[model samples]
Target: MSLRALLVLVLLPLSGCVPRIEVAAPKEPITINMNVKIEHEIHIKVDKDVEALLKNQSGLF
Candidate 1:
């Protein structure tokens, strides 16, 4: 091949090696806020009535 054609072919691939860059700047400060609430309740029951036992035991003494 001719020297001119060979030089053109070699330089074609070098054009793609150039780098590209982009930059951005922030204009305001960032802020975040969060709120949470929790609630709990419990209930219990006796196997036998407690008031009747106290009443029966009072007469035994």
Candidate 2:
């Protein structure tokens, strides 16, 4: 048999295995839930005289 004919016979079976590619998104909708809680507190310490002064002088700050 000819070399070209033999090569064609061998490669013909492999031609059926051509790769197939598919791109798809999720069937259900995508959801992102963020249950976040932010808590903060501030504390100020001053002497009795300073606290009284601040109360008497409203526009000091």
lDDT of 1 by residue, 1-61 (tens): 9999999999999999999886867778677766767777876665466766867699755
* Backbone clash count for every predicted candidate, in the order shown: 0, 0
Which ten residues in a row are the worst by lDDT in model 1? 43-52
Model 1 CA deviation exceeding 4 Å by range: 26-61
lDDT over C-alpha atoms for residue 26 of model 2: 95
Root-mean-square deviation of each candidate, in angstroms?
8.2, 4.3
1-61: candidate 2 lDDT, tens digit per residue: 9999999999999999999999999999999999999998989999999999999999989
